[model samples]
Target: MNTKIEKLEHILTAFYQEKQIPAHLSAATVYSLMAGGKRIRPLLFLELLEGFDVELTPTHYLVAASLEMIHTGSLIHDDLPAMDNDDYRRGKLTNHKQFDEATAILAGDSLFFDPFYVLSNADLPVEKLVKLIQELSFASGSFGMVAGQVLDMDGEGETLSLAQIEQIHRLKTGRLLTFPFVASGIIADKSEIDLEKLREAGEAVGLAFQIRDDILDVTASFEEIGKTPGKDILEEKSTYVALLGLDGAKNQLTEKLSVAKKLLTELGITDRSDIFKMIKQLEVK
Candidate 1:
C-alpha cells in the first residue's frame, strides 16, 4: 500500500475506535470499514488537496475518512442479496454473508450516516462545512449514485446504447468519485471555474475507473481482482464491456485517461505525475 493510504487507514481506525460503541451495530460497521480495498476515494481527496497546495489539517482527514465511510456503506449494500448478491468483496466474505441480512443492512446504514456526524463535529468554518455537506449529499443522494444504481438495476439484461451506459455510470459511479475533487475544491476555496475543471477531471477518471473495472471483470481472475470475476456477465449487467467490445472498452479507457490528464494540465497542475501514475496503474494490462 502507499504510505499515504496507510496513513488514511490509521486515521480511519482511530476514528472508529473512539466513536464506535461496543455493540452489534458497531461490530458490523467496523467489519466492513476495516475490510480493506484500495481506499481510492479518500486517497483522491488527499491527493487533490495536495495538488492544489492546500494545507492539510484535521478537518481534511475527517472529510477523507467520511468519504471512505460513505463508500463502504455503498459497498455493503451493493453486496447484499437484494443487490449484486455477491459472496465476496475485497477478498473476504461479503458483509451480508459474514453477518445476518438485517445486520448487514444496518451496517450499511450506519456507514452512510456516520460521515455526517464526523463533518458536523469538525471545526471548519460554517460556510465551508455546509458546502461540504451539500456536496456530499448531492453526490450520494437521489440525483447521483442512488440514481445510477437504480438505472443499473433496471437496465440489467437489457442492451443499452453507449450513451445510456455512460449516463448510468456517470451518475452511479462518477458522482461519488467526483466528490473528492469537488470537496477538495471547496476546502481550497477555489473559483467556480477551477471547481468545474476539477469536476471534469474527476468525471474522466471515474469513467476510466469503471471501464477498467468492466475490463477486469472479463479478463481478470477472482483471486486477482479480490471479488467475483465475470459477475457482470452472469448478472447481465450493462457495462462498458457489454456495450463496447473488450478492445473498444480499452480504447475508451485510454481516451478517458488522456482527457483526465489534459484537464489536469489545463488546471495548471505542475506535478501531474502522481495523477498520471495512478491512472496508468489502472490501465488494462
Candidate 2:
C-alpha cells in the first residue's frame, strides 16, 4: 500500500511539472492535489485492479490520480463560503483561505476539468477510455455528486427521513465510491454480472464510510478530523447520527461492512485483504 501511495504521489508531482500550466494556477492546483487526504477512491481503484490480477502500470496510476483530482476538486468547492464555509481541511488552510475565493474556484475547476485531459492521454484503448470517461462523468456530474449536493443543501434545517438521507449519500458519496469498483471491473474486463456486484459492494462501503464520518463529526476534535467538526450539526443537516443515534449508527456501519465483505466474497476477488483492511480502518473508534 505504501508503495502504491508513493507511486501516486510521484505521478501527481510530475503532472504539473510536465504540463504547461501558469505559475499561480499551477501552485493552487498542486497545493490542493498535494493536500493530505486518505486517497480512498483512487486507492480502492488501484487495490481492486490488483485484486483482479491486473498488473499495475503508469496508466492505472494516471486513472487513479484522475479520480483523486475530482475528489479534491469537490472538496475545495465544498469548503467554499457558499457551501460548508470551512476554514481548514486536512489541517491546512482551505483553498479559499489559502488563496482567495476566485483562485480557489479556478483551482477546483482545474482539478475537475484537467482529469479528462489526463485520461485522454492515458495509454488505453479508445473504447475503454471512452467508457471510463462516460462512467466518470455520470458519477461526478449532475446525476451523481452534484445532484446529491443539491439535495443536501435543500434539506438543510429540515427534517429528513433515513431513506432520504441514504438517497442523498448513495448519489453524493456512494456514486464516487462505486466508481472505483465499476472502473476496476472495466479495466479488468470482468463480466457485467460481476460489475454489478462490485457496484453494490462499493455502495455499502460508501454508506459505512459516511456513517463513521457522522460519528466522528460528533466525537472528534479539530486535530482528529482535520476539518471543521460538527458542520452537519451546525448546518442542521441530516446524517446517520442525527437519525439513528450513536448506537444505531454504529450498528448500521457494522451491517454495511458485513454486506460489503459478503459481496466481495461473492465476487471471488483474489487479493481482497487490502480492501478489507481499508474497510476495517473506517471504524469510528
- Could you report the Cα RMSD, in angstroms, for every candidate shown? 1.6, 1.2
**How many collisions per candidate?**
0, 0
TM-score of 2: 0.97
Native-to-model Cα distance after best TM-score fit, residue 81 in candidate 1, in Å: 0.6
- Model 2 weakest 10-residue run by lDDT: 267-276
Write the residue-wise lDDT of candidate 2 on 71-123 in tens digits.
99999999999998999999999999999999999989988998998888889
Task: Report the C-alpha lDDT of model 1 over 1-285, residue by residue, as the tens digit.
Answer: 287777677776666676546577777888888887888888788877777787667778889888898889999999999999999998999998898999999888878888899889777889999999999998898988899999999999999999999999898899999998788888888899999989998898888888999999999898898899999998998888887789999999999989988887787654632655676787885
Cα miss at 195, model 2 (Å)? 0.5
What's the lDDT for candidate 1? 0.85
Cα lDDT, model 1, residue 257: 87
Q: 222, model 1: CA deviation in Å?
A: 0.8
